[model samples]
Target: MTDPAAHLLIVDDDERIRGLLQKFLIRNGFIVSAARDAAHARRLLEGLEFDLIVLDVMMPGEDGISLTKALREKLTTPIMLLTARGEASDRITGLEAGADDYLPKPFEPRELLLRINAILRRVPSVSETQSAPKMLHLGPIRYDLERGEMWHGQTPIRLTATESALMRIFSACPNEPVSRTQLVEDLGRDKGVGSSTSQERAVDVQITRLRRKIEADPKQPRYLQTVRGAGYMLAPD
Candidate 1:
């Protein structure tokens, strides 16, 4: 079963599909939000942080492919595209546009449930291994490795789901440079997302956001250092 608090956004033009999915997912222990089209999905995204987005590829105003492409520029949230078209090229196009997975329409709800759980499982979580440090310090901010929580002195700081995942990935191997390709793969993005260059670009956007929380000055990140030819390294003190 997935986390009961995990929120999902469902975008589809079909009212029946939207309602049915919302009801089904909620019954299975998810908090579901339904949007009728791409425009509605955009509005919800602007004001909300969803664990995942279930998007339909055939929306009227802005198709799922287009919306996925635009959202990828800023968000690292996992996206699963749903469409009636089952062609290989369509699936490739959706993945290239930054969708994490594509589920062709006419699929069983149980199958969808399993896919969603699989994708969520791939999201990096806290490292509780005996070898891992219990805490990580980044100047003024402190991270509890076991709890997956961050703090600045006595006050707690909020991190988005993706941000928390990045910390889990980095903290596991501090002072070591992790290539963007590896980070993308670890984040559950398939090779179908595109070339290494494009994949790295997506990871870059996410790193920028993470630096804002960990560094005193994001423009000159001290804790999150960029290696010359390598990738990013977390040099926590």
Candidate 2:
């Protein structure tokens, strides 16, 4: 069962569908908010943070794909797109836009609920155990596996939620090559969040961001090195 207090934002141009989803999700133990369109969603986003966002692909203006792209530029909040049935191209486009997942229209409420739970489960909970030192020494930088915190000497380095999650995944299996598909899945994005091209690009962006903090030379990363045709590996000293 999902946490009742988990906040969710539902954005759709269709009033009936929006209302129904809001009511259903609320009944299933979520704190739900509804927005009529992308513009309204943007307004709500400015004032509040959400655990997840459910967005519809078709809208009067600023469709879900465009909004997803905009949000990905700054936010790491998980997003799920609703697309019409059999729209493979649409799904690919949505993923390219940085959506974490995509659901087809006419989906069962139960399936939606399940998907939501699956994504939420990926977010690590902050607890006492998280503070322990499973430290990875990377030259001038240090990453605490337990706390998911990175530090440069006495000064702490800040990481986005998505970056932290990626670190956890990599640290859990050190020196192992994790495929892009596996990383996307572990990141709690739907299989359709993006096409291979988009997902690859997203991974590259994240890797670059992470390397800047942990690597003495982001241009020539030694700790976070790419494997030939395999994926990426973290070689913490």
Candidate 3:
């Protein structure tokens, strides 16, 4: 058999689903980790850099969307949300909430594999060059895109993989508004949010985290401003 192409994290409340998905994904050539819920997932994330995260939306507490939002603060691993709710609005909501892809429940495992492959395809290969802004001025913070490093004055500020990836994406098109859906796609995350409120709620958490780093006050963001109805924009000075 071929070696595993990537490492995967599977988070679900249901023991059965988690076990099945883990076994299936491993068989298809992936090293898999399983988490019982948000708390467990958080612990796993702190210690691992996963290639992808397969998350189920409905859970006992701190549901998938909440976890997704929290994870985006520090990780760029791809996420695919699975749920029993299959409404069209639900799917759109998922995208708005910063999910890369969404699949309804009772889906064939093969279909999940196909979707996983499709999302992985969107990721740039290691050899591909992602030319980025040499140095970004985020108020007092200076970020080096190529090095994935950040500095406040002469001191260095650590950036998690997710945070570094975010800076790279935003710097690529400074002064441009990036929709939550686009950001989700760029970050390679997938999860569920069924309406405008849900979408904004999830996206807001991520933006808030980013703002705290560069803004004098995250509550009243000066650098990353909301675009009324459009989306979030990064205005670097």
Candidate 4:
């Protein structure tokens, strides 16, 4: 079973298909959102983070192929294209456009579930493993990934519940950019209406506070660096 926590975005011009997919996925233990076309999908993308995007290849405006290519330029989210034409060439085009997987139309809903689960399995989680490094030193501050504790020498630096949650998310994917929207979702604040700007801003504030606890120079961060167009990344020593 895929993590019931995974969120998916469905893009299709057809209203009926969108609604049916949304309901089916939700019933099968996933959070689902839908967009009418490429333009609508872009608007949602700005404010939200999705685990996977299930796109329909044939659309009226801004076909799925074009949007899939554009999305690859900015985000690393996985995409699965649904095309009515099951030809080898059409499938090849979708894959080359940067979609992680593709499915032909008239396919069973059960098959869609299987594909989504498979893709999500490839996403790495942050939970510390016995094998992965546990102690991370960032200058004077030290963190225990296993215990989610921060220390300054022998003294412990306390973290709020929200701060602790952020640490876990960042530690799980150390040296990787974790989008602001994904941070909000991982923190359990994404309520599914859309990605909340208020929540995004909240994450920024939390990052600032976290810097104060760890960075030797919070003014010029060395560990928690912001990726220009992406988001924040935690680079531990």
lDDT of each: 0.81, 0.79, 0.73, 0.78
What are the RMSD figures for all models against the true structure? Answer: 6.1, 4.4, 5.6, 13.7
Q: Which residue runs does candidate 2 get wrong by more than 4 Å?
A: 85-89, 126-164, 179-231
Runs off by more than 4 Å, candidate 1: 1-13, 16-115, 122-129
* Candidate number with greatest TM-score: 2
Clashes of 2: 3
Provide the lDDT at 89 for model 2. Answer: 60
lDDT (tens digit, per residue) of candidate 4 on 106-193: 8888878877776665443445445568888888888887776789999988654456667777877889999998876675445322
Per-residue lDDT over 1-237 for candidate 3, one digit per residue giving the tens place of the 0 to 100 score: 222578888999999999999999988988999999999999998898887888999999999888877776556677788999977666656544556668888899887887777566554333332565567888888877656677899987744334555666677788988887777666544433245454444456557666777889888888888888777887887
By how many angstroms RMSD does model 2 differ from the true structure?
A: 4.4
For all candidates, the clash counts are: 0, 3, 4, 1
Number of clashing pairs, model 4?
A: 1
**Which of the two candidates, 2 or 3, achieves a greater TM-score against the reference?**
2
**How much does candidate 4 score in TM-score?**
0.55
For model 1, residues 1-237, the per-residue Cα lDDT tens digits are 767788999999999999999999999999999999988998999999998999999989999999988987788688899999967667667766767677877999997887788667755555443479988999989998878788999988765455666788898899999988788877654433345665566577668868877889999999999998898999999
For 84-193, candidate 2 gives per-residue lDDT tens digits of 84355655566556665678878889889987887676565555235534788888888877666788999988665567777887877778888887887777554433
Off by over 4 Å in 3: 1-4, 35-49, 55-104, 108-111, 114-130, 151-165, 178-205, 227-231
